[model samples]
Target chain A: MYNPQAENIIIVKDLVKKFGSFYANDHLSFEVKKGEIFGFLGANGAGKTTAIKILCGLSYPTSGKLNVGGFDIYKEREKIKRNIGYMSQKFSLYDDLTVFENIRFYAGIYGLRRKEIEERAASLMQKLDMKEARDKLIRSIPLGWKQKLAFSVAIIHNPKIVFLDEPTGGVDPVTRRQFWDMIFEASSEGITVFVTTHYMDEAEYCDRVSIMVDGRIAALDTPDNLKKHYGAGSMNEVFLKLARVKVE
Target chain B: MKRFLGFVVKEFYHIFRDYRTLLILFGLPAIQLLLFGFVITNEIKDARIAILDQSKDEVTRRISEKVLSSGYFILDKNLTSYKEIEQVFRQGNIRLVLVFGPDFSKNLDKTGNARVQIIGDASDPNTANILVNYLQGILSNYLISLNAEKIPMQIVPEVRMMYNGQMKGVYMFVPGLMAMLLMLISALMTSLSITKEKELGTMELLLVSPLKPIQIIIGKVFPYVFLAFIDACIIIILGNTVFGVPVVGSVGLLLLESFLYICMALSLGILISTITSSQQIAMMLSLVALMLPTILLSGFIFPVENMPWILQVFCHIMPPKYFITIIKSIMLQGNGFRYIALETGIMAGFTLFFIFLSVKKFKIRLA
Candidate 1:
């Protein structure tokens, strides 16, 4: 796959998002290449969700130079939005709708035609081996299946960049592995993946991961390299060491 | 445009697929309209009254017959003593009591006037007042028929009921029903729609979608507008069939007014949803803010003109007040566009203001 060069798919300079007296995201800057599995690692309230929100065009940056998919977020928000698919930590899906219906609804909103939606949904379900559950309501499925389905629906239209915010939250280990396989599959097809996770172990799956502490990037590197550089045996130990250093 | 339509379709699916919301959206208005139109009304009909005849004379009997035949009161019991009055009222059926003095015919024959005491249950002041007024009118009419001596009265007051000729309770209630039903359905629907997203976690999903803040709000509100219209139709139909309230004005004009009112209510609902993150809060706010004001301040059950100045001013700000006035004028008085244009304009202004406010608030939340 063709990877993005210094021309970053996502580029942020001194990004700041404040909620009243509290700065949710403080002077944060980051860059991700095209076709990169960029893991955004942070503890709860580390501004991971806030940063993802800005990148996905859901919220405004207080003062920042932010660009995603070659479009400025402020003026070209519509263009930026069109290029990204976001699955929030909640595994947001309509519980009342069947799996097929949910897929169609999302696809339709993305302006996909009926035939395109049908073809895409069929292939995606086939890949997930979710044909039997396709007609069942989303609420009836297991949490693991729902999380995977949510991730699948997020990128159903094949956005240039897919953002998964804690996508494996509350899911089983097996499901997490299966989910990573899907992410890798998307990356192999030249789709860039940006994911946020509290699970430090899952950070190992990212091609390059950025660890955020107190709304700033405390560390950014490949998981193997981060472990080696920190003199740690695993990504979790590296995350813990970085978190302690930042707190100090 | 296709994307917007798709968003709206998803909204409809959310509404229709939830049987609870569907029932409330469609069923609530129907039930409320029926209840307001038929069950609860101010028009006094077949009220049971007790009569005590101490004279047992012809004049007393003739007057009692007149009272019973007026259709306002039904002579349910003949009480021998005054002690039975409290018992009759406590039973809750008797609303009026007429007590005749011992010299009923003697006084009338000697001075052309007889003393009769009218005792009414004042627990419900409005019902008591109406019953008393109705009894006085019947008595006055009976006396006029008995003696044809025309005495020139000093003050000849010509009272004209402008809008409703008979001042039918249904005429007043139809418009009130429209305001109430629209508020209930619109507010409930919008609140539920917002809460459903929060509950299902789809709001975060939509926030992350390519849809703009405005598009998401429009998508959520669009289906409710259609649902509110359906509720309006149900109320109108119920008002006509059950209450015999004729729509005097142009149906088109009434509908236009109703549309503006629905928009105002829907915008208010959207505004409430923005402040409240839960369905329970939405429902409570809708009920307290929308329902009560629509009922009490909009001339639905009580006259706005009769309220205190502060309450009257508050009523002026309520969208339903203007809507009720326009609707009542149209449905009862057959008022043309020229007559109700000001009220309709006011309603449109409110709709615009609410929409503007909600959009501003929504944008602020996103920002």
Candidate 2:
């Protein structure tokens, strides 16, 4: 069960998204607590992205009761968009632009003032230990550094929630751990983290994990509780146990 | 508004860094103008022809001399009999064959009538037609001189070639090149830049931001408009200084009309962007649907009046047709906004239609 004391920042009930005759996301219900890392796990074509898109206001639902950042999904999409940060599998930094330029570009889009952008960009570079790479073009940096920069840029606006879609894909093991540490640091600052991944080991790092099979969320619980209830050795075994029941 | 300015600055950064795009934006137009203005021309320098004169009389000889000295034809071969005409035509080197039927001077004295046959290879119809027409003109001059005292009732027709008295080739090509260049820069560049962001996923980030979809599209198109305006200025200056193409009308009105045409092209580009999700598709569509049609059907190189009925209908719908007509009216015809009101009005209507259609087609969701 989810923490009873933790406040629900994102609430969804009977959320359904369809593409013509096909159901991309079926009736789904879940709650994400404030300031906790929530893992959205799924196989290919399991509709994890559909759910995330609805929450982020990038897509419309066929029928649903969904709320994000205290705004109704149908009525206040503009409000929800202002309150959340997003990073997709493909990094959205301009390759031809320098690190400082990329940071300024995103911060500028968020309507940050000139003096605030200068001050915040300096501190952000110091925190990421990327002060040296600040003037270097994004294309000249390593992939891991670029991924970390993308995440830092995404949260530069200090949104209440950050939705990361496979942020550690193709990253090495050590870098993935470092990325999770960053996520934890972000969560400690009272920012909610909703991330999707296919890596089972990463599921244990989340405060709560949801396993989506087909279009429905098959399991939603803490990693240890999910393992204990399924009588499995790890979160991986629990995921497989739930995913094996194929939907018609 | 500040956020929109930031977006435009980023677009400029992308454009400045991509040297290939920069070249296409600025260099291609100048090079195309020079190539079209100087290299590709409508005038014939020297055309080759063969003569098969059966009656080698004084009159026929004098006519052949006059035709050769007209500077349009070079006598490639002289044949003795009728069989040589077909052989020389099949040689593929000669463009025209002139044959004179029996005694030309003797027949003129007896019956005041003569027959001269000018045969042209019609494989390349334009050049063949020009050659035949030139031969007929020279023949007429000779006939008028010969019958100067004989026919007092000859009605003299006075002709004058207006607008381009010198018959310079650049006058026809400059307006056309302007239309093609502006379309490529304003329409093609905007669509490509937009679809590039979609492919790179940056567009999604913009969508999720506080920036509205309209703001995003406007920002993406703003830099191209600035660059294309600079391009239009360069085309006008070069056309004036290099080719002596005068902007005889109000220069301000000419530039104003150019900007309006640019707006129409940009709206078309946005429409193209809305319907496509990939840069390659956007580029191919811009080229096939915009560039090729504008160049061929807009009466740029070929006259719309000369095209087939079906194609003339297609040309009427083409936006470039109106744009080219307006430019020529302003530059060559020295007409003001009053004279070009119909053309400018049609272009404005096209811009509104495209903007309305694209805004309708644009959807915020993949669903």
Candidate 3:
């Protein structure tokens, strides 16, 4: 069951995931609101993927009070799975499958009917201006196009929230802009976007950004507020100020 | 159920699209079976030998004729002296040297015994041993016929090879081939396909979907079951038509047993995928852990009884050993359920054990 009244789509409190004695995610708490672009920024080993996986129901938390898309993380994992979509840092589409086939397969697994899958797939191809690539295998496409198609396929079922873990990692600058434009379009359509990225310039695009350092959030605020608070000119400078001291 | 079907359809796409997978799935089985049947066999034929006939008597000539005409050996040279025995064997084309003692007919009639020195080249010991056995068989049969009227109270043991009358190597290889091919295609290919999803990061997307873990596993494994069953059929048909290996038992029983074996291999594949995160690791594990034991210790190429006792213990645990036994009994011996009941039960036990372990080891969530 969905809670239409719940403003925060993802709520986490004291979330912790441990590996033996090492805490991959330590006391991480944040809230992602409905229809908002939330940027989760961190360094390579700062546990951004761990938190994203936990929120997407791809991993269990060691101990936490968490809910995703209004479903209890512990008790209603299957429900959480139905209500959200995830795109990992690695390319998510099957390389051997054609674009339309990839779209149809992922959509079908989420319980979409055949007609629904075909209809949505055709419309998605039109929206992305990818009619020529519809029959092309994913491996034949460019990495930027693959990432974009992966994002579209992830949200093919119109889930309440979509989680992108470094979706634009290897994409060129022009394609990254286009990718973000697609993200904005999805958010405008009332889908909450929870994206994790190490690129600081990408951070300025989010409505609000949280920077994690050493398995804990170092700062959380709007991009401009963090810049002004840290007396920096850009989000990059703010990030350096937040994470550099801890690095030393 | 629809979702599961769609997942299986996707799995078929993955399998059919890759040319390498297609080659490995269908091509390897035929090639391996033919190779095992014709090229790599234990049966010796047309082995060359040198005969030294010191006695110009009828008995020695008949014995030499019997040895050379048995079709197992060809006369390379007729040596005139004992010194030529070492030289002929050293020449290396001849596999054996048959040296008949001088005055052989006189000695056998007067002393009731004669020495025929059979010196075999033991460099390739197995072939040498087989040639010696064939020569002995021919000589003993000739002696039996020569003494038939004189000896009336000799107790001759009647040996009847029960199932394989010709003792064709092909009959043995058909079952062994089925076990190996099914295990390889079912276990190695399935493990690779599943771990491929993990390696390429598509597993993360799959894990987030509404499809449960069990659904994902079954979907991934279902297509391989179909493919491996087809492989089993191909091997059986080829073995029957090409090698004339009989399927004397009920075809339904044979198929049921093959289905059970394929299930066991598929479950083992799932177990391997759960433990390893990379396709390379899964492949290595399947090859090293499954293929070697199936070929060496499962009574495939080497008889398990002839192996070391420790290896026999290992063979008992090898799932393929029971399967090979079941197949041989069913295909060659034409036995019904009652005859191979213990082996069938053991195979079922292995299938259940592997399924249980894989389910227990399966990760509900990515770690």
User: What does candidate 3's lDDT look like per residue over B1-367, in tens digits?
Assistant: 9999999999999999999999999999999989989997778989999999899799988888888789899999999998988888887899999999898999999999898999999999899899899988898899899989999888799889988888898889999999999999999999999999999988878888999988999999999999999999999999999999999999899999999999999999988998999998999999999999999999988888898888889999999999999999999889999988999899889889988887777754355
Docking class of 2: medium
Number of clashes in every candidate structure? 1, 0, 0
Each predicted model: what fraction of the native A–B Cα contacts (within 8 Å) does it retain?
0.74, 0.79, 0.90
TM-score per model for chain B alone? 0.92, 0.95, 0.95
- Give me the runs in candidate 2 sitting further than 4 Å from their true place: A1-3, B364-367
* Order of candidate numbers by TM-score, starting with the best: 3, 2, 1
Better of 1 and 3 by lDDT: 3
- Model 3's DockQ? 0.78
**Candidate 3, overall lDDT?**
0.90
Q: Which residue segments of model 3 deviate by more than 4 Å?
A: A1-6, B364-367
Per-residue error for B97 in candidate 3, Å, reads: 0.5
DockQ of 1: 0.69
- Tens-digit per-residue lDDT, A116-169, candidate 1: 999999998898888999899988998888888888898988899998888888
Which pairs of residues collide in candidate 3? none
Which residue pairs clash within candidate 1? Answer: B248-B334
lDDT of 3 by residue, A7-81 (tens): 988899999999889998999988878888999998888999888888887778899899888999989999988
CAPRI grade, predicted model 3: medium
Residue B70 in candidate 2, Cα distance off native in Å: 1.7
